[model samples]
Target chain A: MIRLKVALAMAAGIAAISSAPAFAAKAKSEEKADAAPIAIPAPPPGKGQIVFFRPGGMGFALGCSVNENGEKISSLGAGRYFILVTEPGTHQYSVKSEAKDTLGLLVESDETQFAKCKIKMGIVAGRPDIQPATEEEFRKQKSLKLVDEDDMGPAPGALRPAEIAAALAQAPAAE
Target chain B: MLAIFVATILSAAAVEAAAPESDGVSSADATEMVLSASLPEGGKAPLSDDPESARRDITIPKLTPISIQILKPLGSKLSKTGETFPIRLAAPILVNGVEAVPAGTEGMGEVIHAKKSGGMGAAGELVVTARYLDVDGRQLPLRSLHWAQSGQSRVDTVNTLNVASAASPLPIGLVGFFIGGGQINVAEGALADAKTAADFSIALPQVSSQQAGTGQELSEGDLAVPSGAVPDEAVDTESAAADVHQGGKE
Candidate 1:
């Protein structure tokens, strides 16, 4: 009887351990399905916006983190993008890896701009380069996804996800 | 002596005027030339619209292409990143077959990137973007001017030479290191086409309100704010109306 009880407890423990991964996998898939599409709204009055993206290509394993000043705004993984609303003025963004490249943009009120990051060959590892891009170029990449909220740092100047949602809600619906 | 001096001055002026010119006007003369060209013919009023039609606003739709010329020479070697240069319209902006913004209206262009040629066969590069056109003392945003150019690259030639020299002991490939890439240069008056960045609504200049029964002209104060100045009250009303319409849609 003792041996049977011990055997039963071990089997139960093994079953729970085995089922945990499957349950986690199911939850992850559900979350992904719920977050399929992300809509970006027009910038508010007196503000300008920029969309930064990284298309999956060479150096896919490396992260292209956009930084303003010294703080990390967000990490642009392979095939990911993020929108940042900014004040009307000059803004400089930089990406660093084995080397660093910077791009400066003159933002105006009620304007939307785009920037793209690509990996280039460097002396050590691949270097990240940021350049001015257009809306047409951005749309060419068909499989772009929104950067995960967890990947963002304390970007005080940027619009948060909650703010984006509120703005989208206030925007007029598409016909 | 005075006659000779006057003759010399006249000859110099004649030579300058008769010189073979390139695309656009000189930077120093751009504003004056544009202003004089845009002025009303025969010193008449600038607005040609009838008094009744002046009350309406003219909308310049988005993505309307405007031909512009750079006022000065630009190049990867001469330009620095983040610099703004003067530009002028090469053609007039038409609305309903009438000239709205005339040729020579001043605008601004910004250098987004400028990299001089570097060693090791790297080429010089330049990228410039149009910012806005100054129309009636207001900024009409412009965009889609992705004027970019790169100098000739010598990487392949350098690599070939290096491979050929590898078989010999003289290191002849080292000559490739001295060869520099070309520079991109946009001469004065070069065309840099741009498009309207967004929908721009310009308020037309309104005539003075006629004094009823007196047949007298009203004072300037009674006239609707001159061209392009949309009243704050009117703006607020428009915003309110837009909000109401959006709410109704929801």
Candidate 2:
């Protein structure tokens, strides 16, 4: 009788040990399967970049981009105009006119949509400090952060209304 | 209960993993850049009400950045005794890309000029043209033209004449409208005819308005207000301000 009782106790211990891992794994897997989902938001919009500028900024010049676009894209030009709105990708651009010439690259964003940008008319040559703005140069511009060079009279690139009017007063007849 | 909890957590984790992929772009969180610039109105002319021509044909070319001060010297007609008299008819000048003068500019019909049909002479109508440029000096393509403003009024027919050229995406050019209708005729005898002409000069951005007596007419009281001044637009926004703040390096 004593031997039988001992044997039964041993058998019960073995059964308990074998069942533990299976139960634990089942519980874990079930929890994983029932977990709640996470919420995700929508993507953002795209943007534009300035590609080029004239060497001697003065009368007129040119530039390029894959930035802005759409209806009323240009308030100045009320028509359907837009910049290339795309992911962060590279594009080719150029400028060639009777007065001047230029070339550059455009990097766009992939996450959002882009629109047509208002192209800056390349200015002619006259000013000494006026230099063309290239993609590489623009990169430096972002770093140094010269909002508008104010060392000069009204400051470089800064045109006062009176000055504009004066330019008007002194504007030579059409070429 | 524990099983249920564990299952819920696992499911939640899976869901989280599936989400956050709305943008496949690596720099999805980049800054929002807005590239806005002023442009010209070109391409096709607006349709008019003329029957002979289905399109109210208007052609605009991109005008360069040039400035001119308009001066109007009002002259009158006279009788045999040399007495001043009001003339009945008056005609407007026409040209391409010339905007209307803002307040404080010399006088009405100051260097007035406009004509759609080539701009050299008047076709008994007013026309305008202009170009658009960005703050950075980039220009729109010649193909994309829309509309542009010249700080002028278009509705006033009889007395006040102000007009801006319509533009498109490209800075084709601008031509403006002026006074029209009939010529200002003088009475049978006195001062032949009361002609309207502006005696103004053109200058570059370098000229000093003060030296040119522009201050005298500036109406400081009214001009100080920005209501009439040209608007300054912001440049295009750069990318990823948000991301830069996060995982991006300093």
Sort candidate 1 into its docking category: incorrect
Candidate that would win on DockQ? 1
> What fraction of correct interface contacts does each candidate retain?
0.05, 0.00
Residue by residue across B1-250, what tens digits does model 2's lDDT show?
Answer: 9999999999999987665455453442323311111111331122223323221111123332222222221221111111222221222212222222221222111111121211211112111111111111322211111111111112222111111121345433222223322212212222111222222222111112122223334221111111111112221112213322231221
lDDT per model, in order?
Answer: 0.69, 0.24
Question: Can you write out model 2's per-residue Cα lDDT over A1-175, one digit (the tens) per residue?
Answer: 9999999999998888898999999998876664422111112234322222222121223332111221111111111111222233333232223232111222322121111212222223211111112233322221121112222122212232344345336633111
Once fitted onto the true fold, the runs of candidate 1 whose alpha carbons sit more than 4 angstroms away are A1-38, A157-159, A172-175, B1-66, B71-78, B94-101, B105-108, B116-127, B131-250
The TM-scores, one per candidate, come to 0.51, 0.14
> Which segments of model 2 are wrong by more than 4 Å?
A1-90, A99-136, A139-175, B1-250
B1-250 in candidate 1: lDDT tens per residue?
A: 9999999999999887665344375542443333333334442234334554444455788889889999989998899998899999999988655456889999899998877765445456677888899998999999767575566655445556666776989978777667666778899998977889888876545533232112233222222232322222212222323322332232
Candidate 1: Cα lDDT at B67? 95
Worst 10 residues of 1 chain B by lDDT: B228-237
Could you tell me the lDDT of residue A113 within candidate 1?
Answer: 76
